[model samples]
Target: MILITGAAGNLGSAIINSLLKKVPANQLAAFVRSEQKAEQLKKLGLNIRIGDYNDIASLDNAMKGIEKVLLISGLSMERLKEHTNVVDAAKRAGVKQIVYTGVTMKDAAVSPLKVLMESHFQTENYIKASGIPYTFLRNTLYAEVIPFYIGDQALNTGIHYPAGAGRVPYVYRPDLADATAVVLTNKGHENKTYQLTGDQLYSFTDVAGMLSEVSGKHIAYTDVDPVAFEKHMKEIGVPEIGIMISTGFAAAIKQGDFEVVTADLEKLLGRKPTPVKQYLKAHYVG
Candidate 1:
């Protein structure tokens, strides 16, 4: 059976939905952390297993008889510890191959998630050493989240950020999910790394221009002072530590930290990824 951990999440749900089209329901298994989530997956016709990242024993039990596994990265502070447990359990369960969703962060990138990038790479190394056939899907920033970064505040308050000249090759989440489904179902992708991203790049200025065209309003991208931004974040209850790390990332973006381009995603999905403007027009204008 092909098992998907963190099965109730967005990425997991997308992968599962796509898999249902290609594989039978009995061949699919979902690992969740609660009865509510289990019942939800069961409603979709999946074999359900309950487990948590904190509970290694449950993970071990969940992995039994599962041939292939999708190890979705966790968002917890103890992520490394939790992911390590899955790797160990998968190995002992005689799983054939494992796939992981990881991030693509340059060592020099200045973002709040830089520490997360370090941990991700460390986990990649550890998984490699474990000797199970593996695929590390180093995903780029999601186009879905670009709006949150831009928000409705951009329409009324203007787009204010420290990302000066940084460009991001943002791909839609469903596209990434489709590429992942391809890797999961097809053979010959084992023991490889794919930097999945879009065919084009867009800076924040490009985003503002698109917003202006679609919304029929003047939406400006402003290069704001980092100190002012930090002060505002503090006033709004953003933690000092969060502000410190985020400031670094925002500054790094100005240095072109997220400026990356790749075609690995298109080759896998057999189609062009969704354009950023399509999402912007639908969500921002309507």
Candidate 2:
């Protein structure tokens, strides 16, 4: 059986749906925290396993007999103890291949997400030590996440974030999901690290231009200092931790760390990844 944790979440659901097209639903097991979520997934014709990372025994039972497992990263910012439970349970369950969805902050020396990198590296270490073959899909920023920051507000006020007009190497989640499904089903992808991202580089100014063209609304891009950007986020009541993460990532983008594209994702999926503007038109315009 192939187990997918966080099966109720957006990324997990996308991955599960993609995998279902290739593998039988019964051959796929979904591990979620809540009974409501389990019921929902069951209605979709999935094998349900009730488990939570907080409860190691539940995780252990849920993972038993699973050949390949996808450990979708959790959302709990300050509380990462749950990730530990998953690593231990997967270890004991003797899972054959483990695929992890991780952030693209791989350069430990110059990474903006210094604090967040530790958890991903720790998980990577655990997978390496587990005696199970592993694949790390080191994902870039989501394309959809951009609209949440620059969308309707730009439509109304004509101005979006002023993070020095940096370029973002946004990755489409559905594309990432497709690439991941290939690894889960196909062989010879073990112990590989894939930095998945979009086919093109897009700056914030380019984003504004795309939105304006699509929506027929005039939008302007402003360059704001990092300090001022953080202050703006705070004045708008953005959580401190989230602000730090956003600011650090924005700084990194401005420095051109995310502009490079790799063929690893396309080679795995047998197709090209989605472009940023097209994704925005599909997601935001309609």
Candidate 1 per-residue lDDT, tens place, 1-286, comes to 9999989998899889888888888888999999998887898889999989779899889988898999999988789898899999999998999999988656633555566566778788889999999999988888777665665667776788877768888888888888998999999999999999888888889989988888889989987888898888889897776776567666766766666677899999998989888888877777
The digit string of per-residue lDDT tens for model 2 on 32-69 reads: 98889888789878888897888878998898789988
**How well does candidate 2 score on lDDT at residue 216?**
83
- Worst 10-residue lDDT window for candidate 1 reads 104-113
What's the TM-score of each model vs. the native?
Answer: 0.93, 0.91
CA displacement after TM-score superposition, residue 82 of candidate 1 (Å): 1.0
lDDT of each: 0.84, 0.79
- RMSD for each model, in Å, please? 1.9, 2.0
